[model samples]
Target: MTERGEGSNAALSKYEGYENWKSNIPVMYDWFTNHNLVWPSFSCRFYLQGTDGFVPHTLMITNCDVVKPRVKNAEDISQFNEEEQSPFVQRYKTLIHPGEVNRIRELPQKSTIVATHNNSSNVLLWDLEAQPNRHPVNGAPASRPDLILTGHGNDVEFALAMCPTEPFVLSGGRDNSLVLWSIQDHITSLGSTKGSPKLGPRGVFEGHDAIVEDVQFCPSSAQEFCSVGDDYRLILWDARSGNAPVVKVEKAHDADIHCVDWNAQNENLILTGSADKTVHLLDRRKMFVGGVVLPIHKFEGHKDHIFYEPQWCPDRASVFASAGEDGILNIWDHLKVVGNNNENARAKTRSAPSGLFFRHAGHRYRIVDFHWNPVEPWTLASISHDVDKTGCGVSAVIMLGTTMKMQEQKHGRHLPVYAFDMLRQIWRMSDLLYKPEEDVEEEVEAELIQYN
Candidate 1:
């Protein structure tokens, strides 16, 4: 995505190009709508540019059924009926190619087109209410973005969380602040030829003493949001409120907080991982130490500084998975407190004592980030760094371990074995699978041969 001022002219050229492509390309209508010979599914695509001060470059749509294309010769264009030749019709005629006339004839009447520029300085919204697809170009635009949001003081490091409600987006930056923006307004304001769209901050959450590392909205509530920072603090805020956090937890870890996630099942439960080599679970309702902080558990197995991202299981709220700087990824179950009557104490006494379900230590270098696939709960993805004689590279590794198997081996002496292997750069089991002394090498060798 290009920056605001830098991309406007280029985006306008692209917008014109899209119009020309729509008019010229016959295959786009068939490809986009799947040639049902009738109505088809419609959607919008957005393009954005810029980092420090970005803006929307284009907002166009394809709603070709309502507005029919008006044909006119180059010399007799002025003679075309003004009432019949709307702005879209004139623009469509100018943009489409002559050879794609057959495709335009098959255009659906009810299509929608939407595009956004980078950074978010400029936004354009096509009145697709009346206009339909008359442009003919297919895959003419190299890239199209639906929304372009800007106004970050520094480069954005990561995508924190998207708003569960409303057309809003939230992001954290090195500037030490969290920004909430209304993307819906940014898109709606594009049609305004008057003053610049009133695209400004909806709310600025500022409790972090250091650069904010991560920001996440409660999965259950739209108004509730949480942010973690390098200052070792996790602050919970009501987005409708002002700058100060409604609730705050201090000294979350001894080191900087790197990542945080909220429990999908419980809005009050928050999980945070930090450089202090500890992960803390805090109850949002209990803002103070004297206010009953629910300490679920903490994992302290990593030998080196932890750098991997922590994620919770999609199916089970009490289960969470994490990877670390020690090149090990672990899955842990947060022992649930049955009732309010010292249930945790009772369970601790009767249980065989479970700490970690499965641990995979196979990366050549440190595992940078890991993610649990939403589609398959048992599957996971890990990105790791490799700096060996072969050269420096990054690998995406997939792990397949069923949750049922993990629970079965919860307190067993032998943990359930899970497979971890490389995905993109090469196909091989991680070094963790190659323990020379174990007789299991014979079994692993056979497995490797089968995969190869």
Candidate 2:
């Protein structure tokens, strides 16, 4: 519960109640699970390569289960067994203590837990499952990052996409380059007696006219990768090739391309968002297989027209999300675009319908970026920035579908909020992964209203 105000007596009562809640493990755990609270399990730490480097801190989890008033003192303490408690709870009693909760009312959704000061241009990798208290298997600090691969001359952006098929890392940054590194390289670099030998770059993807904005490995093929950039181009390269892109799509957008996502269901489909205020669907198969150039579809709706990013839904093959300067979040159905195209082709002879299946108008500011929750495909988290008014700021909101009613029911609250925006930007809630089509509907019904 959010504390609205603090009268001296009321504050004391709140503290007394908090102390009671912290002392009871079973009651607290049950309350947490029943309310569907999520604890933070992973964090990302970043540091500028030079001056005063490698500061160590801890990233605290946010959106924890709400604490409730304690049961009467007579409640059976016999039900509490030492083994029932999580190691985390035992180590951090302050996490459950009311005094701590009151002091840190808003949990640290995302923060730098560790700092690095290596002068070599390198990228850092943190193992998500590493225990916070143990040394990493490499004998570098455990529960901390397994390795730090320093080798970039410029600021790194999106430099840590973990490959699903292999224990490798794919990253690109302002240096106009891409590098693939292995976990073993990190282990060896630690120089610990027990550390594994450091691994070096497995491969490097080069050849871009400008700083690369995004680089994605094909979901099904580790042999191929795609990238986009400020030069308004999309290039597909062979992972084995250290030279130029085999296929260069110039003018992929009219302005700088901010993001790119490959459709997991259809490897031939490429989706890109740009500062040009347009989202383009390029049929990769057409370019490579048919030797034809065709834009499968295009979306234009943002007023200010700066689209920051686009994400393809993992559960549904045809579904996608895009956010931009208009401050609206859009969910789209690609099936509708294909259907409309087929109908239009047949209509030099007849007249095709002129609408698409999509949903919009869910945010109040420029949604800087967003990610679909990996565990729950129906849910998404986004960060929005409102820069026009006083006290206006950035916030994070979790979007839920009607299907997740059980989880929503557990929380007893459903409206979105702006409190967690900064957190969403730090730790990625999910990665773009391909799912079997059998798990989701192939056709999207046209019930969604079109956004103007």
Candidate 3:
């Protein structure tokens, strides 16, 4: 930070360390990124490396563009505003209460939150836009339940998922049951201040003999969905009818199946993670050959831990990633998983041997669940058990950019890092991340919007 009285050369002399580091910014940026671990976001550049004794807190960059401008190129960045320019994370810490919050998910529109708890049959829903009173407002009720889904039997519910195209909530439980809840009916009941009838499942699907670990609706259709369970069974159910499964394949895997996901682009492809320490990509069209649908591609890399919900990349349909009980995030491209480049490699490995494209060791304990950002395919959010060795539990969400071209990130004289319009658009909910007390966007719109 140079004083007004100091000239350019004098300021350089006054802050020798800053001058030295500023000159090496571009070189440092280039040295820190690559094909395996790309730095997709602008904030990942100088986030935890501003001070003299600083190095970046985390290193997980995958791709970079040499042509884009660096933070040093910003014409009028205020030196004192380091927090705004280089905030690596924006954390929101509010406990959901009571339940251990085994799994949490943000809806497709990013407008609501749904969470499942350990040893509980009920599913909880909280509207993101709601501003309910946290404390007692004249002794009425403190934090009334937004919507309590009482559709399950006595057994604990394990998984909950929202349909992207419709207002339906799908949940599967240890009671060996699946319940479909209508969001419209829940909201309608909340709107009636006089209080309406107790809500119930729009439809209930039942067939699994053991605990239901995961349930996910197909990305393209609201009526169809799949569930995996401890009984080593994969059952496809129709939302309109819940009496029995449309398709149930017994002995689906060697061990228990932990989770399941639908391909974002291809409706026929299904992905499943298992306690057997392998991932199977299955084709729903002909999975049941002689009473069993064989795996199209099987991946083995997570060693001895469970891979919790292997997800298909939203942007790149062929690319997918998985979070495992081993506390690692592995990204894979079905075409590039195995090291075989021969002409018959695809044909040979289509049903057999496959490997990992990239692996990220981020968390310390078991990672129970994770979700790909609906808007940005490269971005992801993962939550860990955080166990006895570390803290209690930690839930993490990171938005990775860089699939499309991006402008250089520069800081300015006013506002926070979010004041930059380019960043604001990249994360549509930037306003919620930084609650600026005063107007800062007006002063720094022209420079940042060029990137947007």
Candidate 4:
């Protein structure tokens, strides 16, 4: 993909922020690592494996530069001859995928068991542990799928999820149907197959009018799940009640809904991101009232189209993260926005949107995907499609921490409040918000003066 702001006034201002972020990394993060990918990937997920040996912690990614080259114009060409490159990522293992991976989701019960979707009707499952490590290069032979899921009449590119409660897999496709599968019996024999094995869905639900963009299983149930589609509809499904939708919100957003994620801590809450540039928080219990479903809170923090699913922080009940074409990953505290009546606090932070406490501006391009590290507290792994000088994409793992101290305790210190304006200003002045060249320069200068 071509980098934004190239040959424009915003180009310098954008890289200035990146430099500032790199300089402040030591203070802003407890730990940080950036690995350059040989090819860009639209999806990234932290593996279930621990960090005891050869690999720090296994990470799953895809390579698709052969399919869609990232070097598109002179601007990208200029970056091809840098003297040095970012740290290289060690390949724990590689799966020669059948096609470019449009999206990826792992079985929560078995992280080694991964399901990948492409521009086809089938969902390919891989037992990463059993798959032989192969070097992926141009025209490499495609690896056979350990298990293949069939039922979708069209391509199931992006909408895919795995159940947290059971060995169930959920997928949505262009066919406008939600397909469910169980890998319970196939788990033990996952890697035993030398040829392509196939599995069919236990049930198929039809409701969406357009291609399904995202699907999420209710954290607490195997039979309960939800889906959002290009039709601007959000449908909740229950296998116990047959193929029909249990609850369908016809107009979930003003634009196409791209993603939907159900909260694990609070079963009552669900998050949906749309092209409308908003994340709507829906309460399942209060979904249907007077024959209409309404969102409990509308998060208007994103400034561009929301492309990826908004993910909930596994450890925190009210915290979550959302990213999109805006090239920003915003961390929000729902409790801070929902029913918030503190006019004083609102006035002090009026420059930013309500509930937005932290913003990640590390990526120079749009953030395509991100996953919260369940094993690490407040840690995140994010990937962007921006190509570097070495013809590689950026993958970063960051542990979130605030330099702003909350309080001083007897034994140690507290640094809980991360959204303070002082810290936020560092990124905001560095091109997080678009402004005229003169204004941006003046604001950045003033910020430097204040710090000096």
Q: Which candidate is the best by lDDT?
A: 4
Give lDDT tens digits, candidate 4, residues 1-452.
Answer: 11211222332234636766555644444334344433344564521211212222223332111101111232322232122322222223445555455666667677667787767899989876687766545555667778999999988877899999999999998899999999899999988977888999999999999988899998889999999998889999999999999988988898888889998889989999988889999998887678776788788876677778899987678889898766678988887776457843783578888787577777766566776755435656676554332232222211122212134433222222111000011111112232346896898799999999
Give the TM-score (vs. native) of candidate 4: 0.74
TM-score of every prediction relative to native: 0.52, 0.57, 0.64, 0.74
In order, the Cα lDDT scores of the candidates are 0.43, 0.44, 0.51, 0.65
What digit string (tens of lDDT, one per residue) describes model 1 on residues 1-452?
Answer: 11101111221221323344334323211111110101010000110110111211112211111111122222332122211312211111112111100000000111122222112222222323322234333433322223334556665543245555545556666667787776554544443334324355677667766777677778756677888877877878887777788877777677777778887777777778767656676666564656544455566555454443477777567667675555455666665343344646665575322345445443434455555534332444453433222221211112222211222222121111111212101011222222233656776688899999
Question: Which model is ahead, 1 or 2, in terms of lDDT?
Answer: 2
Q: What lDDT is obtained when candidate 2 is compared to the true structure?
A: 0.44
Candidate 3 structure lDDT: 0.51
What order do candidates take by TM-score, descending? 4, 3, 2, 1
**Candidate 2 positional error at 208, Å:** 0.4
Candidate 4 residue spans exceeding 4 A from truth: 1-16, 46-89, 137-139, 288-292, 343-349, 387-452
TM-score of 2: 0.57
233-292: candidate 3 lDDT, tens digit per residue = 999987666468999878777888878989879888888888777888888888876765
Query: How high a TM-score does candidate 1 get?
Result: 0.52
Clashes of 4: 0
Q: Which sequence of candidate numbers ranks them by lDDT, best first?
A: 4, 3, 2, 1
Residue 440 lDDT (model 3): 44
Could you tell me how far off, in angstroms, the CA of residue 67 lies in candidate 1 after the best superposition? 46
Across 1-452, the per-residue lDDT of candidate 2 in tens digits comes to: 11111112321222323334335433222222111112111111111101111322222222321112222122332133222321111111001100001011010111111112221245544322232432112223313334555556676544235444545556666778777665533333332324323346777777776777677777776667788887787888786765568898887777777678887788888888877767788888665335434577776655445444477887777878776666555666666557666744653453322223333332344445555644443445554433332231211122222111223423332321112212222111111122234432332222233331
